[model samples]
Target chain A: MTIRKIDIFRTGLRTFFIQSLWNYESLLAYGIAFSILPILIKLYSKRDIIRKGREYLSYFNSQPYLAAFILGMLIKLEEDAVENSINNNSKISSVKASYMGPLAAMGDSFFWWCLKPATLIITIFLVMYFNDFSNALFLLSFFLIFFNAFHLYYRFGSISFGYKYGEDGLKFFQKFNMNLFQKVMFQITFFLLGISITMLVLKFPFPKLVENIEIFKHIEFQIFYGISVIFLFFIYKLKRSPLLLILTTLIIIFIFSFLKEKNLVFLRIN
Target chain B: MIFKVLLAGLISGLFQLDQTGAFQFMLSRSIISSTILGWVLGSIIGQPELGLRYGFLFGIFFDLIWLFRLPIGASTPPDYQIGSSVAISSLILGISFFNPKFIYIYVFICLVMGFVSGYIGAWFDVIIRRLNINISRMSRYYWNKGKFLKFKSLMLLGLFNSFVKAFLITIVFLFLILILNPILNFIFENIPGFIVEGFAIVIFFIPALGLIVVINHIIKESTWKVLGLGIVTGAIIFSYLKDFHVFGFLIILFFCIIIWVNVLKKEKV
Candidate 1:
């Protein structure tokens, strides 16, 4: 019997609990095997089923969300293997394994690197600016449902493509441009980061900038602030980590703080 | 009390870090984890504000700090959810338990605990993932019989193991905090006030470091102008409109809207 809709749906849902069997040696191998248990059981009887399990329970990892696409594709491959009695076990595993790295790179960039922060920064902006704690729970829930559902929807769609065309379905990955979304979201996140940082600087005056309102209004101070932020851009350009910028800035601030505490404060711009 | 905290710990850990993540539904985020914790504590204390306010602050900072922790491939980032939950709930509960009259030092301790627990939590995750691998060999039995139900049963055994892992982490974290809290309180009471102020300063400064890290991510030649423009808007708001917080957020909001529309509009073109 061919795979039915109920089976596809069950496997998709089981994808969530996949990491329950996670281990370092094969990473998510056992989890992958577990997710496709029904398909394996139906396709292979007795020892053959055990062989399929053993085949899957070896070294697998990916961005978990994108793994759904891989899972969908693997189910189709497995079904094809049984239907044709093809000795394609190695091909199936390799196909799943190969897709993991690239999909992970894409998912990590799009979901982890981009969307995660974008939603977070948006939430921070809303909560802090309004200072309204109301619906903080609702907002969190809304975010959880929206982003998770977006990827899940994509995963369900991905499975169909994977089944119909096998490896060719990967070409569809190109049609989905995550870079543009990432760019826009990154822009907004940076803009808000600027605001949030400025708010902190103002809320907790950097000892030296505390003295005069006029000091900040000065073009020199504006330029100084601009340059400092641009310096952050440079730090990123050098392919240096963000942690370095934070440490350096913190050291700079601490030194200024120490100097001020010792009455070694410098002359004012005025 | 222990049971209550244990239950919260399980929910936080499982919800945030579930590996299979059905339909991509698990958030596994510090913000949501801590918020859920805070809301739980708030409901217990009959003070929604307590849960929400603390959750928001702790969540924001944790979100900022963990920005770098994108768990790609087999590599795992520090498990901020379990750590933050342990840290947040301990402090929130402390307020009620000790009936502390002041807030600042308590908040400072929570910040420090956040880092401490985050480190521990990350290590715990590594350990659990390592241990869970053992289940793979055992899954062979179910596989032999083509027993899909048995396979799911084994996976549940593994999922329960996850909760067990979380339980261990939370217990250790809470135990240390409890043993140290009294001595620390005494020392804190005796210490010079500036030291306390310094802690507060450091805690407040954390957001900036976190924010800077995020800004660092989007840096590119093309984005520099956008970056510059954002800084200008921010500085102007800082310099002139510090008091106009909402109006300023609106200004930023207005900019975001225009930028979003322009980008989407351009893509369509």
Candidate 2:
């Protein structure tokens, strides 16, 4: 029997909640199982239902956006199993394992690394600089909308393409260039940070730094660029998490205040 | 006491812990959680305005710091909810009203606690995942027995366990703060006044760390020259138009965009 549009749509919806049962043992294997449960139930007899469910319980993992590919392939494979057309159940696992790593890497780079950082930087900048809650909210709302919208598109795109290509959808993904998009974003993020660092330094009114405004004026732009260079080199060598690095800076300040100054207590600022 | 603990538990569990039922739509975020606690605590203390003000600031500030982390698969990001919750609760407790200046120390202490809690939260997830995997096993068992209801409930147990774990962690942390307040205050009081003044300075620089992460992620040795040249040109344009700051920034921004367009378009060609 052919898979219905309703089944395909329902399977797509199921992809959202697959992580509800996410466990370390099988990673997202259970979520994958749950997503395909409807298809398995419809295609298999009651006796074969448990067997099919157990099949998905094997070690399976991937980032959520690309999960549509796996779900699409599962639907096609289940249909074949139902018809007694293929006995090689290992084919499903092999295809899943093969495609899982690359898709996950792509998802991580695109969604987590590039898109999230950019959205967050914009939202944070709005909140910090403008001091306007509504502005940040507006940007965040637009970001959330755009982020989820693309994922939904990927869902539909992955399923349709996965169904059309069957196992070779893996090959289809290879033909698609995630790197070109990544490179463009990489440049944008780099450029934005340079601008943000300059703005941050210029706007901040440091008492000591302000006293030397005449001097800072001459080298103010250079100082901004200098900090950017220092920061880049520091991170390059340290390879420490950014938060941890900031925490260390905080620690250094705390210690410096006590050690460098005559005493722990100093004159209070208004 | 129970009410506050329960409230923290409910919000944290709903937002960060469970991450299901679409409830996370508003709860999991630092902004919402901090504002909720700030607003609620203010009402309890009859200082709603101040509570709301600090709550939003803290939320936004931490959200900036939390930007770099993205929870992918088994690699959970650090928990901002823990930090926000701890910060709000402690700030609302009474320190802000005391000297106002003393809140700086509390901010430092609470944030440190929050960071530790976040790591613990990640560890707790590992434990929760282990427990949930057993539910999957149990569901498989029930499925074998043809007990479909049992299978369904067993599957749902995983979701329930996440809530329970989140709820417990929040409650315990709340109480831990209450129990440890004396010790925390002692440490706070002992901290040097110079350090206290320096903290405000440190907070401003913290965002620099975030910018570094973004740039570090993007930098490739191959593109360094172009990246350097583009920014230097933008800054030169800004320096030339220094009188009107806004115009200078915009012109620089426009210059960057033009360069970006040219660069990308050239790549296309």
Best by DockQ: 1
Where in model 1 is the C-alpha error above 4 Å? A82-85, A202-270, B1-4, B7-10, B13-26, B96-102, B145-147, B236-250, B261-269
lDDT of 2 by residue, A149-217 (tens): 656667777876787678777665656565665566566555655656554555432222122333334
DockQ of 1: 0.39
Model 2 TM-score?
0.80
lDDT of 1 by residue, B1-269 (tens): 67666666666656544533233354656677777788787787687677766776677767776677765556676666765677677776666544243345666566667666677766766776777666666666666666767767777777776666666676666666677777767866875543443333343444555666566665677666766677688778778986786787688889988877877887788
Error of 2 at A261 (Å): 6.9
Write candidate 2's Cα lDDT for B1-269 as tens digits: 56766776676666664243222233455655666677677677787655655565556546555556666666666667766666666667645334455565665666666666666776777777788788878767777775656765665677777677667766777778777777766776787776765555444444555566555655688667655664565456445654565665476567557756876797889
Best by lDDT, which number? 1
Which stretches of model 2 miss by more than 4 angstroms? A83-88, A168-177, A204-236, A239-247, A255-270, B1-5, B17-77, B92-98, B190-194, B222-256
**Candidate 1 chain A: minimum summed lDDT over ten consecutive residues — where?**
A203-212
Docking class of 2: acceptable
Error of 2 at B245 (Å): 8.5
